[model samples]
Target: MDRQAEFVLRTIEERDIRFVRLWFTDVLGTLKSVAVAPAELEGAFAEGIGFDGSAIEGFTRVYESDMLAKPDPSTFAILPWRSEGPGVARLFCDIQMPDGSPSYADPRFVLKRTLTKAADLGFTFYTHPEVEFYLFKGQPEAGEIPTPVDTYGYFDNTPHGMARDFRRQAITMLEQMGISVEFSHHEGGPGQQEIDLRYADA
Candidate 1:
């Protein structure tokens, strides 16, 4: 076996891993997971796991429900947030037809194909996303904006407010997971926030 692949197999075996989580995303970028016991890893690698593609959004039709998920070993990483006590890590999979052809509709595959085109043209595609989201109480009604969870503005401190502390904790966790944060600030919109991640090679 290759050095890196051998190293990963050895690490998993030595760590007493009980489960291997296969991770992937739907067309809309929603994260998905399928966990298998360690005993199944070898089989999974040799023969991709079968799943019903029709069940996933924008995957396939009912008549052609058969599909496979082939794990990409390189994306293996311990999910730091999952409280599994450290022996477990995840591998992202690429979707394929039951016959083992790449699923063109897979969003990750779409991105990969686009990047390949860029390579053929002597350029590379890069993406740096600025994530913006809000933490609201329950679900707000139409045309009705929810009130800010806290009155803290920018770096202002409101003793009773948990939002400021939450942001700090979130940034810390992101850093722990190796994500570089360029900056974070309270957006002009009430209860809205923005986090700018540093641009880097993927």
Candidate 2:
């Protein structure tokens, strides 16, 4: 086993981690996860865990549904939200076929392939994404638009801005996961908010 994999095993045992969630995304970029017991991790690192890909959107058809999720040790991190009981950790996985080949339908594999091609061409790909979202007062009725939490505009700063507190909490959690945020602020629309992520190699 590699040094990273060994390190992961040691950490799991020391932390008393009970569940390890293997994470991946479908072609549509929807996050998917499957949890495994800590005892099965060594085998998972060796051969990967199998699942039926046909159930996921944009994956293989029912006939060729068998897929493997090989966890990437480098992306392992303890989930901060689950602070009670035995700890829960997560690892981003690389999807593979039954024959141990990279699946073309895997979004992470496609991105990695693109990054490799870019490196071969003497270019480094980087991205700084500005994510925007709206805050609704509550869940709306069927077909009815929800009301905005506030009438805040661009860069608006209020002493009692709920959006401000939300952003602060979000950034804190993201940092705990080793993700860096460039900045965040209110957008021009009512209850709209924006967060700019730090530029990183894609």
Candidate 3:
């Protein structure tokens, strides 16, 4: 087995991991997930887990729906916010055909193919996403706009607000997932947050 895969197996066994979530993105960049039990992880690492590709956005047609999700052991991380018990972890996956060929419809494969071209040209590419999301006070009714969780303006250091707590929790979780967060702050819009991310090639 590959070292990363072996490491994952060891970690799961030693940590008493119960669930392992396989994560991947569809062609339109929508994230998809499937959870596997720890007992099935070794087989999954060897042969991949089967799923219906036709159901995923832009993945495959109904006629050619058979697919495999091969976990990328290198992307393994424990989900920090999961309830304390048998640990829950996640690994990003690369979609593949039943015959073990890389799936063209997989977003991760598309990005890797583009990166290979950049590599051939003596260029390395990196991405730092400035992600933004919102917090609302309550669920919206039909055709009704949801209220902001807080009225705090940009970087106001609001005292004891839901937005502030949300940001703090999100940052902490991101860090635990091995993502380097540069900083987080309130955006100009109410209840919106901006998080600057940084990833440098070592």
Candidate 4:
């Protein structure tokens, strides 16, 4: 095991971790989870836990329904996004068949496979998402026109402005969780703003 993996296993034991949550995404990149108690973790590390593959979207057909979720220890991290406890930690899993081969339909696996190919060619994939959204006065009704919440231009700081305050709060939370923010600015459309996240290699 590498130093990081060793540290995670040691921390989990020393910290009295009660649950280890395995996470993965579907073909459409929707997150899914399964929680296993600390007692079963070692077995999970060896032989993966099984579930009904047909139930999950795009996993398997009804005739052959068994699938497995094998956790990759390296992805273990405390879920700062959640406030649950016995304190939850998450690991990304590789979906597998009952006989132990990787399931091609897993979206996480697809990303890993693509990254692996990139690695073989001496390249890496880096994504920097610029998320843009708008805030309106209230939910728009059927055929009801939407109006801008504020009239502030790019980088204009007005005291107690709703749009400015909301974006600041969101960026603060993102930074607290170790996400780096490059910039935040008002977009061309009214009440619309954009937050650009800094890029990093996985």
Please give the CA lDDT of all the candidate structures: 0.75, 0.92, 0.89, 0.81
Worst 10 residues of 1 by lDDT: 151-160
Q: RMSD, each candidate, Å?
A: 3.5, 1.6, 1.7, 3.7
Best-to-worst lDDT order: 2, 3, 4, 1
Model 4 bad stretches (over 4 Å): 1-6, 81-85, 133-178, 185-193
Better of 2 and 3 by lDDT: 2
Per-prediction TM-score: 0.80, 0.93, 0.93, 0.73
Residue 51, model 2, lDDT: 96
Candidate no. 1 TM-score? 0.80
In candidate 3, stretches whose alpha carbon ends up further than 4 angstroms from where it belongs are: 140-144
Which candidate number has the best lDDT? 2
Which lDDT tens digits does candidate 3 get at residues 1-202?
Answer: 7999999999999988899999999877888999999889889889999999999999899999999999999999999898587799999998999999999988889888998998999989888789998889888999998998877777878768788788889899999888899999988888988888886642
Give lDDT tens digits, candidate 4, residues 173-197: 6786467999888777778888999
Error of 4 at 133 (Å): 4.4
Winner by lDDT between candidate 4 and candidate 3:
3
lDDT of 2 at 37: 96
C-alpha lDDT of candidate 1 relative to the true structure: 0.75
